[model samples]
Target chain A: MEERKAIVEIKNVNKIFGENHVVHDLDLTIYKGEFLTMLGPSGCGKTTILRMIGGFEEPTGGQILVEGERVEDKEPFERNVNTVFQSYALFPHMNIWNNVAYGLKMKKVKKEEISRQVAEMLQLVRLNGFEKRYPSQLSGGQKQRVAIARALINRPKVLLLDEPLGALDLKLRKEMQLELKNLQKKLGITFVYVTHDQEEALTMSDRIAVMNQGYLDQLDTPERVYEKPATKFVADFIGESNIFEATISHMTGDTASIGLEVGNALCLLEKGVSYSLSEMVYACVRPEKVLFSAGEAEGFNIKGVVKEQIYVGNIIKSNIIIANGQMVILSRLDIDEVPKVGEAVNIYWNPDDVVLMKSRGYQIHHVIENASLGGD
Target chain B: MKRSYRARNKTIPLLTTVSPVAIWLILLVAAPLLYVLFLSFLSTDGYNVVFLFTLDNYKNLFNPTYLEIYANSFLIAFFTTAICILVGYPFAYHMARAGKRKKTVMMVMLMVPFWTNSLIRLNGWKTLLGKTGFVNTFLQNLGIIREPVEILYTRGAVLLGMVYILIPYMILPLFASIDKLDHSFLEASNDLGANKVKTFLHVTLPLTFAGIFSGSIMIFIPSLGYFFVSDIMGGGKSQLIGNLIETQFKAGNNWPFGASLSMMLIFLILIMVTVYKKSGGDMEDLGVM
Candidate 1:
């Protein structure tokens, strides 16, 4: 990425509703014209952060600077920020034209300019002929487009979207994901989107901000977040991972020789870190990164029985239980033939594939097992 | 054939749900209304009413004396609705949007007057406004006036009585509508660069207009016919259409003329209510929530 300028800056912002600390001391900066997604499970304070930026919520502490102006104490309309609400929030009493034209009308823009802008906005959203129809008359996708149009016509410095396509069906959500990404690129407006859907964040965001338990865990590019998660909760959230609790037996240069339940493993150490001898840690590797060997291969020592293979399109997912009853998940392409269930197989991953991090006191597998029980 | 088959199967449940209200409306409501219509067309002597069809009662409605009463009734009912909107709207808006405890307190405050009989409440008001009442006596004691003020039996007193008794009807519908309004709409409005006042005009007010319209109906229709309020507070000095009908029934001994007046008022109410319903006024929005 090129040198980016900051458009919205949140410094040590905290939000507390009643006795619940929704957002803890958080510091983040959203760049100009980049599509950033705040991805987390429910109750992770992503929406609260978006609300704070849009001025719907005031932070209990800290300051928010949009375009270098202090905005935490301002009303939503006082700042040049608009929000596309989760429910669309289109005015039921107004038709499509009026809904899109609402901001301009409030600004006391000339009536002819309002008319021209409304028409142009409706055309841009591909709802040009729907100006007379109420929100109830439109389909979910159309309403979503209208909501986007309504906010964009205001030319807000930053557009805050709270799960804008959450109400759409699966196919439409996919289409809208691409459409919104393209629209953001075309318009070049900073968009701060919030969602619980990890796939959506990965698909649409230029950078993804993964959060957990009111704490921003990692803010990085989608590829880096997927491949090099900075925290245990982020690794658990973005995708499936096989986390093995291990002890660093020794450090040889930039590699940490880890002792796993199955056997010894080597994980490449990240730079600028010194590991003490016999330090407890976790080595996480994605299921698809593990290679299944047909026969005894060089340096392939660990062995497990083929447990279950789930066919999902071209990719096949298999669960392998080692001799000690420790289960490991492996994802492979259907083109690569694997042993049938109950058949013994050798499995190993390259040192670069393993992610080594200091233990954060909780069992990663426990969170993984209950992760689907989403936010409160 | 499939739709017809389904329709037949649906009839039992539909009839079960709808028949009770239908029967009640037809027997109790429609029957009395038809009798009143028949009575309005009959002739009445100074002593007894005769079941002879005549246009005399209808023609009496065009007389200048009754015309003045009709105009006064409209004027007072209009003012009552206007004042109720000016006062009750803010009260309902604030109460509906208030925090839970404050909302409950305000709701209880609005409903406390309804706990007692309305006539008894009006009589209580008569005390505060009557000669040597609390207000006049207090004023005299303060040396603000040398003599007690005559406040009762005036047009202003009648208007006050109507507003005091009917303001609750205005409040309930507005509260219901404002409460049921989607909270996101207001946030969206504000996010779209409209301030609080502009959002109220552009979104909040339009969305809750159903409540205001229905509340006006509830208040204005009843204020027109609440004879007891005018009788007790205005001392029957400011005669409304209700007072006119009441006198024709009791002292005037002219039942046919009274029936004609009632029929005319019913038509007027019918037109207003029809317009209200046509303009997206849903009773469900009248704060049923």
Candidate 2:
């Protein structure tokens, strides 16, 4: 794959608010015309990164480059990036037309050109008739469209959106998600979006940068990030997966044998990555990858009892307790009859379907604590 | 029957909550205003008011001397309000953006002067601006001036006194409105490629305009009627309509004319308020209710 030149580069960015270190030594590259999302939980520094890129915030200890030029000293207005704020910060006093035309007017653009561009941008956001409505008079979705129109009217090289659809209802958010992705594709402008919604990130972004505690856990295409997470945090954060601690028992060419208490299974160590015998590792397998059978099965299979079964529209979700008493979830299409609770079943998975990652030392402890606390 | 039930429910709540304030307003405010209006329509003889109804007092209000005093009062109030805005705006903006602890400290400092009587404070200013007092003495000793310059008892002194007394009124409402500004709008402006000045002009100033209007009214209206500051600081040469009305009631013994002047001030205030209401200023911003 040919790597495109980056439109925005964040290098060793750190932000400290009072005594709290919010963003730490974060580095990222947003390629031109790419829809990149920074996904994380709240307070995980995703919004801070977006703000730094939009020049709303200054990195305490590093440089940010836009179009290969350092913009650390530039004010927000001096930068070529615009932001769609989460609150949809449309000026309360101005109508939609003036709000969208504000950037062009600030640049002293000609009156005819300003109105033409404003109208075009409003139409692009599907807000053509809302030109005369104040922000307070518009619905949340309409306000969001106006904010997007206002930001895009400047024709900035990169648009930074900080959870722009977070205020909408779920159905509207889903619709706007597709609309925004389609808009980005049509405009061919780089989008640096911040969102805590992993599903939204996966649905819209060309690439995802998953963040945890101010560090980039993984950055890759959505399919790759989902199928082969670089770290345990990314695997646990991006989707539903059954993660367990396993000990490496043997190593072979491009593969390794990890021991489970009830049985042993063959798992592939990451290519060009080192693993040692008797080392602890985190093994993740998506619920859909775990196949369930009513009887004993051959090849890396474990005998377990179905503890609970839930029918969710098109899929059946069942919690199975293996022989060693470790619990793992199994999901399968509901085309087959529902598995009876307390019925004995065998769970099987192919070795290649599992992902092996080095332990994120404290994450296991945190998850364990959370699980224990969840019990009444 | 249902409509009548609903009306009864609403009326009971309204009566319970609103009647006390309405009665108090009628007794203390409306009664005095009506008495003044009636007095303004009556004729006065020497120190006594006659029962006969007349418009002579209202006609006398157009006298050139009274007109000049009204003009002086307007000019003084205008400058006081303008200066208050010029000084208070930046101060309020700074306070609004300060850190929590710093904002609290500044607010307390702004309120410290209010603990003492404003009259006493104006007297303190008189001492400072007096010929033998702090400012002139210090200037004389520094050889900047050979003699103590006349600093007190001037038009400038009256304005200084008025602004000093009314600035707190200007600052509080301005602070409330400026501080209430959604900071995200400023960020949005910056993101739209507006520099700080442009952001302030296009975003901050327009949004905080209600504060400016309310604060201006707060200072301007009171400055028009506050006679003590001029009496203490202006040496009588800067007598405003307030002083003229005061003299008419006291030394001049012309109660009808004095009542007429009070009514005129009220009329001006009403006009100003009407203009404010028409200009999109929120009545809630006035903090009157």
Candidate 3:
């Protein structure tokens, strides 16, 4: 949250590979020393943007400025930027010390200096005494650490990481997430991190750029991006949400009365701009934000029948079908008494909890459904 | 007792399965090698083996006339391998980087020479490189040259023939190793402040050294021992160790000396192979170790 000037600026960059347009009209600015994560699904151009910054990819139609100078025509080695590739990309034939010292050696640094710096880098990555081992001998996490050390020893003004922890198991990935965050903070260098894992972005990034199908969907702080998603895609991607089609029936001052498409019940939109009367819209509310009551509550309320209840360790996840056969999912942990299947229940969400956005056509729901089908 | 019996029973099937290969190797490969080694220790008159134990065959190998032939053989083989590597590396690198369809087409083109026997291929080269061959005729007809030029039956012809047949050997292993190169390493090298040339030296070349070594060995070994190319293309002007040994066995009728020459070549090849193995090459890498 420091008042820092922008260190890297992308001006409407576009990347097209053959007929496949991978990145489209991307504009972004990364401030000094901030860990900015490009978070998206597999084909969302997050990696392409990181590569463009690292000089591995040249933008088709725009300029990238690093440290106030245009770098679109520069080679990766010509720019003051380095990348930690997703697969580690350690040289198999070189020992650990040589791998970390590769950039220094290429710069013709003195042998003793290279050795000292390499040792210091290894220690920084907590990989001391591993200089003699080849890359093949190291485990996945160790290889990742070596790759980080290798890229960091160059001391580039900007560091780009492309899913560097993707190969690690869940537990290791969590540990690495914290380590990378601390490393970035300690070095006070800008890091452009790319990953499809929303949890990782939320954990380490100062600001997260959410991408969808080669377009920037939303760029904001993790909390804001999660709680105040700008689009249906952002809401669906960041966390579990109960999203359904609706229409704005009426507006009173700043509040819009929305009619749910499935249940045909009216609910007040409390947190968003009021839409025109009879405009189609999308209604979204987080699963955890919804409170189930046996009777009425002081907020938007809908009645539904419990279709299934799933016990997922600490929390119970339940699916409820309203009278019109529309499904709404909610997770509850406070209730001691569990609801039985087929039991009629009232779902209550605060007015502020409901997010109303203009509908993005029919395929948006289909994409959300398919994406959630593949578990996080 | 039951566990030992079970282990012993396991060995019975393994042994039964492996015995055929062992027997075939001993009969076909080992027996001839041992016979040649035995013959190398005997003395030879001009007409027949004297059947007497002697070291004269190896002593005769040190003669300057025979030493010149060995040196020439080494020089030619070295040139052949060097040329194969110089030309084959870029071609193989391109093949490795090409799309799947182009790669298959290029590979098939490389193998087309093998469909016709190598001897026939060598003869085809001889015909093309002859004084009145296609090249000279084309040049003469194009008015580039006034008269036919001597193309075949020269040292250059011999080197060209050797390189032509052995180029595929160099290319295949190079393709295999280069294709398996992790592309990320090159990108990583570039990201680490190395340019294209530096990346190739530090990453690409060293990573694919195994292929270069194996391909060099493949070209060098055969170029040394296979003299038919030189015989057909060199026009009796260039005599290699293989031709010398062949002459000793046939025209000179000195089998012991020829056997000694064969033994020395085998010993040299074994040493090269042992060095390759010690330098980190494994049989599983390319079956060259």
Candidate 4:
């Protein structure tokens, strides 16, 4: 694919709050007219990155380029980026019309032109005939629409949204997410969205940047990020995955023979560093990719007993205990083919479905082990 | 039947909670106001007040001397309120926006003057502004004037005392209102491309107007009836409505006219309060509630 021209580029961005390092050396590029989302857990600096882009914060050491020009020192208004904050941040004193017209008024636009643009933007947000109502008088969804109208009225080069649907009910949030994505596509403006909801990121973003502990874990399309996570953290964070502790027995060409505690498994080495003989590593496979049966498969299958079975709507979630005693292996079965609890079963997965994660230091082993055990 | 019984039970606690306040209002507030309305129509014959309905007190209030006193009282009150707001607004705004430690310090400083009796503070001002007081002594030492200047026994001194006594009353309420303002609103204004002065004019001032109006009324109403400040500070030369009413009842021995004048002061306060409420500009919009 040809590289598109970057509408906004962040180079080596770092933000430190007193003693806490919030955003580490981060580099990213946002293409023009692309809907990009920064997805992370709370306190992972997603909003901080959005704030830096909106000129609400200054990078401790780095450069932020907007339209190929550095805007590190520019005030929020001086930049060609407008933000719709999580709180909506609507001016309570002004009615919807004035709230939407505020930016134009600041630019000293003609009164007639401002009214025209404000009315058009309000209509775009589907809030026609409610121009005279104050923000306090509006419902959460209406307030959110007004906020969008206010931000879009300026016709900025980039639109920054910091969890704009966070205050709405679940149904409204889902509806607004679709509306916001459609609006971004219709406007053809570069949208930099920040959200903690992985589902939201997957639903709306043309590309999603997964971050963890102030580091960019992976950045790719939603399908690629979900199907092929770059790290154990991303795999664990984005969706459910059944990870197995194993050691690389031998490496032959593009495949590595892995020895699981219960049995042997094969790992196709597609990315990351090479594995050595007897090197400890993690083999990760999605629950949906794991097949369960009452009898052992022809090859590379482990025998286990179904410990628990839960029917969750369309899917049956089953916890199977493999040969090494209490180590539970999670698998999702179709509701029509769910096995009963305490039934003997065999679990198997294709070699290509396994993802290899290089084991970190001994401390991280304890960390990951504790995390898997659900300990704080 | 059970639903009606449950509804009545729910209302019982609410009624019990309001009963004491309702009784207090009827006896203390409503009874005195009704008595004043009845007295306003009665005629005074020497020391005896007859219940015969007459408009004599209202008619006498229209006389030039009484009207002049009323006008002067208004003018003094207006000037005092204006001065109080000018001095109090910045002080209150500073207190509101200040850091926690600084805000606490400022609040203590504002309340310290009130801790001492108002009469004591007024006497302290008297000593400071007297002809042989510290101010005149310091100026004499500097040779700015050959002798002590007559700063006391003037309308200016009366205004000074009134403003000093009432400034905190204005500041406290204004601070309470302005402090509740969301700091994000100011940030939002700046983000929308407004300069600091423009933001203050379009956003800050209008939002804080409710507090300003309430504080102004609080200062103006009491200043209208506070006679001791003027009596001591103005040396009884510049008598206000308060002094006139006091003289009518005590020195002039005219109880009925004094009652009528007191009633007029209450009427003026009512009018001011009504106008304030009618303005309908709320502080909640400014995030100050």
How well does model 2 score by local distance difference test?
0.88
- Candidate 2: tens digits of C-alpha lDDT, residues B1-289: 9999999999999998999999999999999999999999988889798898999899999988778888899999999999999999999999999999999999999889877798899999989999999999899889999988888999899999999998988888899999999999999998787888999999999999999988998888889889998999997878888898889889999999999999998998888778989998888888831
- TM-score of each model, paired residue for residue: 0.91, 0.91, 0.89, 0.88
Can you write out model 3's per-residue Cα lDDT over A274-350, one digit (the tens) per residue?
Answer: 45566678878898877777886643457888999888888888899986777788887846555678888887676
**Can you write out model 1's per-residue Cα lDDT over A30-144, one digit (the tens) per residue?**
9999999999999999999999999989999999999999999898988878899999998988999999999899889999999999999998888999999999999999999
- Candidate 1: stretches off by over 4 Å: A261-263, A293-304, A322-327, A362-376, B1-27, B286-289
- lDDT by residue for model 1 (B1-289), tens: 9999999999999999999999999999999999888988988778998879998989999999778888888899999999999999999999988999999999899889878799899989888999979999999989999988889888899999899988889998888888988899999988888888888988998888888888888888888888888899888888899999999899999988999999988998788788987887774654453
Residue lDDT tens for model 4, A1-376: 7778799999999999899899999999999999999999999999999989888788998999999999999888888888888888888778989989998898899999998998899889999999899999999999999988888888889999989888899999999999999999899999999999999999999999998988998999999899888888888899888778888887888888888889877778875675667777878898778877777665566788888876777777888888887445555547356678888877877778988887674346456666756545
Query: Please, what is the whole-model Cα lDDT of each candidate in the order they appear?
Result: 0.89, 0.88, 0.87, 0.85
Q: Supply candidate 4's per-residue lDDT for A92.
A: 78
Candidate 1 accuracy as TM-score: 0.91
CAPRI classification of candidate 3: high
Off by over 4 Å in 2: A1-3, A250-257, A260-266, A295-307, A321-327, A360-376, B1-31, B49-51
The candidate, 1 or 2, that scores higher on DockQ is 1
Could you tell me the TM-score of candidate 2? 0.91
Q: How far off is each candidate at the interface, as Cα RMSD in Å?
A: 0.8, 0.8, 0.7, 1.5
Which 10 consecutive positions of candidate 4 chain B have the poorest summed lDDT?
B280-289
